[model samples]
Target: MRLTGTLDPVYNLRYVDSVNVSYYNNRLLPGGGRITVSVPVHNNRFSAWVPPLPAGDRLVLRLRYPEMPDSAGRILDVGGVSLMTGDSIVELSIGKGTYNPRLKKFALKADVVTGEQNIARLAYLGAMRLRNNITDTLRKKLYEKTIDSMAYNTAMQKASELRDSIDRDFIIRHPSSLQSLNILETIIGRYLNKQGGWNASGNKRLTEIDNLLQALDRSLRDSEKAQHLITSLDRAREMKLIPFTGIMPDGSVFDVASLEGKVFLIDFWGSWCGWCRKSHPHLKELYEKYKDEGFEIIGIGEEFGTGKEQWDRFRKAIAADGITWPQILNDPARQDVVSDYMVQSFPSKFLIDRNGKVVLRVLGDSEGLLDAKLKELFGK
Candidate 1:
């Protein structure tokens, strides 16, 4: 493959040794091999031949500039290169890249044009723009105040809408492209363990994901990455319908199915998690106010330390905090309780109605929303 790009005229190219190109088998994984080749530079333009790479490999190019002496100290510029490649002639320009003086690295911003159809490139670009925009908006909001459940839920809703829009517009346009498969894989991995937000219509969303997977090219659908995505969706669906059993802190057996006749909550938490502890008071109040009205909660503690010691400590802490709900301590050996619920993060919660159907699932405390939902389920 041929690599051609222009170097900044401000930097002397004499100190440059060779341009480095790195490729990873899977862009999702880290630690890949690198290939470096010396290229001739004449009048700020450089051309080099990259040894033929494997048919499908993600590429990254790096250019480090020479250090120059200044009044304050020595300054150096390193250009970060982002590129998309395919079996064809590729051209790139790098002049307006962002540079970090401390790390001496420059970040090059470029849209990659791969061997896939132009539609694939457009989809990738559009999706990336929406992702970055959502990230920036949330970052700014986070600086102003602590992120509460409402703010986080709202931001997540907006992001889900953006993702759905990208999928509907782009993936549908090029269902057979590898680019489309990659985009779908990303979305699948993101919500694999999450059941709420955009995934509120649990079974319907799972069905849609399955349909998309089936829509891919036969070869691509049978690939390892595709299989993994399919498996994740299946597991999430199965877990939603499965009833879990655990041992309470007091050595009593606790079965989730036993609480089928009441509106209940499955609170997955950890002692080490600050948010889990912070939410205890509100949960306690809700329990006390609604206990006689058939409101029940099953606290599932995700213990990381020795089971007995951690369980004892957690019991003491809950008592001290006035949490009188039934507590189920996780058995590290048999962790299906956590896995069945797809509890990736602490403070995960699921609200179930009298029929044992999940009404809501959220990562953090649902705050007033939980209270509101309980009231709706069992009127105060």
Candidate 2:
């Protein structure tokens, strides 16, 4: 597709030697690749031909100025463009704009030649802006130590609900929009790592996401990516442990099945993770308090690599932290198991019941949520 743009000098365009342009397609996939190109700027004007977007796959464009900073001195995650029309000719005139209070970000207004795609682009901008605002606020709170991990997680969940509400409104208003389908897929995918199991609120979010997907244009709902997302949502509803054999630190085979019919915690952590190291003390306390009561803890150490240096670091960390629990390294043989468990972040904990069901899943507990659960279970 033909792309041409003139930038406003107010954005300090003179300092922007060139713009980094990239486009993302098949974004619903777990590992989608981005194609990027560098285009030079001359006298605040630049033009280039971007590849056409394939059908049923939404394409999102992004621009970065490696040397340019916004007036706030922040290289704001600046500009966005969402293209729904296939191979449509488009033109843009971009300019620096005032900070929008509602979206809580400094804005960049783009005058596009194609009106429909422009509206979709604006909707994408709004959704992303709101998401960034919420994320920034949470990060600030966490950085200031104003909120613990449990409260931070709770706030993040609330933020997700707010985003879903906004997306719901956008979908209802523009059921035919590909951006709406994108938003629906995002909502459905969020349930993959959601902490609580299929509880009341979880079921509500599932129903809401499914209903919104059905509300979209039939072409979008039937697309390959959308169908994949729907299948993923169905799988997320039936969560369970993937039984596997883990190799303990002493080179002995440890089958997770042996822990069945017992309450235990599976901790996916790494030695390099600061928060994981911090929680070691609390976990030790809990282990000592409840080991006699049929409670157990399993630590899956995900090191940077399986080299000798990495193993030394892992073992040294366990010794230094005084971790007495059975620790396993997520080596090549068990990497697939970690993938099966969908451990996307460090310090992911899955609390399993006697029946081997995942009662709760949390990331970076910081000793609050897990402590409470243990107390409720063992009456300590």
- Name the best candidate (by lDDT): 2
Compared with the true structure, the alpha-carbon lDDT of candidate 1 equals 0.65
- Candidate 2: regions farther than 4 A off: 1-4, 9-11, 22-36, 42-91, 99-121, 127-162, 174-178, 185-202, 218-232, 243-262, 269-274, 291-296, 299-347, 364-369, 372-380
lDDT of 2 at 104: 60
lDDT tens readout by residue for model 2, 1-380? 66667777764444555655566532222123466666888888777676655543544444556554445433234446544444356566776667667666556556675546556656666776878798789989999999899999999988877776787888888887766776675565355555544342556667777788888889878886677676555545665666777777788987888898889998888778998888888888888888899999988877764356567888999999988888887765444455556566677887888888777777765377777877887788
Query: Over the stretch 1-380, how does candidate 1's per-residue lDDT look in tens digits?
Result: 77676654443333444466665431222122245566645666666676776433456676654564442221233434544444455555544345677765544444333334433664577577768788677867777766766887788788878767777556676766666676786666456535453255566667777777777778768776577567656655544434778887678888877887888888888777889988988898888888898889989876544445677777877777677778887664554566555466778887888876676767775687687788788877
For residue 13, give model 1's deviation from the true position in Å: 19
Worst 10 residues of 1 by lDDT: 25-34
Q: What is the C-alpha lDDT of each candidate?
A: 0.65, 0.69
- In candidate 1, which residue pairs get closer than 3 Å at backbone N, Cα or C atoms, i.e. clash? 78-106, 80-106
TM-score of each: 0.51, 0.61
For model 2, what is the alpha-carbon lDDT of residue 160? Answer: 73
lDDT (C-alpha) at residue 211 in model 2: 84
Best by TM-score: 2
Model 2 poorest ten-residue lDDT run: 24-33
